[model samples]
Target: MAGVIQEFKEFAVKGNVVDMAIGIIIGASFTTIVKSLVDDIFMPIVGLLTGGVDFTDFFITLKGAGEYPTLAAARAAGAVTINLGLFINACIAFLIVAWIMFMVVKAMNRLQRKAEAGTADVPPPRQEVLLEEIRDALVRNSTRP
Candidate 1:
């Protein structure tokens, strides 16, 4: 039990574990923002461009005799409906999130490459240069003697 507890403590304190937890929390928050952007902002513009066809109200009745105009009405009438509009909204949100993540990863990769390039161009420290010269001198003297 003590070993298990110690392992758990170690795992909990790890930077990777903490970073993952923070990423998950931020991802969830980002999902909400994306969902809102898709449903509230983009969908409205799409509806306007497509002659006021609201996607949220679009659905097909799977198991019902009465014809319902909207998804909400179909649900209210206890009719089974395939809400394609909601699915479309979800897809749009997913795409937006995916694109943003892709851009972020691309930027990070670019920065990482720049940092690596910069490090490669840096000269060795003066102390290291002097140490190498001393070592070479010692080697030459030892070889002579």
Candidate 2:
């Protein structure tokens, strides 16, 4: 139990875990912003483009009263719905967030590689300079004799 507790403490204290937690919190907040962007801005424009058809109301209730009318109506009546349009909305938001995060991670990796490459020291190749000089001297002496 003590070993487990110590391990947990070590894991929690690691920079990577802390960074991941911070990232998750930021991601959750970012997700809310993205959701609002999709639901409010994008959907309204899309609705106007598509003859004022509200996609959020598009659903197929499995067990409920006649039609259930809208998403709010279905939920208010406690009806189970497929809500495929809402799923599409969620997918759009997820894709947008994922693409943004990919760009960020790619830029970070490129910078990290650049920083590491700049700091790394590459050694020059070695050669027998002293031995070559000694050998040349010995060869000249033997030739003179």
Candidate 3:
């Protein structure tokens, strides 16, 4: 029991675990933003361009009869519906999130490469430089007539 508690403590305090927690929280918030962008902004524009047909209302009635104007009305009428428009909206949101994550990872990789390149440009230690100079002098003297 003591060993399990200690192990749990170690895992909880790890940087990776903390980072993952933060990522999950931020990802939840980003999901809301993406949903709003797709539903409220993008979909409206798309609907306008497509002749003002609200994608949210695009559904196929399976069980209930009679024509309904909107999804809410169909649901209120106890109709069985396949909400393909919601699926389309979800797909758009997923693509947006994917593109954003790709951009973020690309930026981080670029920054990491720059940091590595900067480290590689640092000069050698002064002791190594002096030893190289001494070695060159010795070689010059040995090769002299």
7 Cα displacement, candidate 1 (Å): 1.0
Pairwise lDDT winner, candidates 1 and 2: 1
Q: Per-residue alpha-carbon lDDT of model 2 for 1-145, expressed as tens digits?
A: 9999999999999999999999999989999999999999998898899999888998999988777878999999999899988998999898989999999999999999998888786543356777778899999999994
Q: Which residue pairs clash within candidate 1? A: none
Candidates ranked by TM-score? 1, 3, 2
**Candidate 1, superposed: residue stretches over 4 Å from native:** 132-145
Where does the lowest 10-residue lDDT sum fall in candidate 2? 121-130
Task: Return the top candidate by TM-score.
Answer: 1
Query: What TM-score quantifies how close candidate 3 is to the native fold?
Result: 0.82
TM-score of each: 0.87, 0.75, 0.82
Q: What would the per-residue lDDT of candidate 3 be over residues 45-104, giving only the tens digit for each residue?
A: 999999998899999999898988999999999999999999999999999999999999
lDDT of each: 0.94, 0.90, 0.97
TM-score of 1: 0.87
Which portions of model 2 miss their true places by more than 4 Å? 120-145
Q: lDDT score of model 1? A: 0.94
Q: With candidate 1 superimposed using the best TM-score fit, by how many Å does residue 137's alpha carbon deviate from the native? A: 8.4
User: If ranked by lDDT, best first, what sequence of candidates would result?
Assistant: 3, 1, 2
Put down candidate 1 lDDT per residue, 52-88, tens digits, no spaces.
Answer: 9999998999998789988888998899988999999
Candidate 1, 108: how far from true, in Å?
A: 0.6
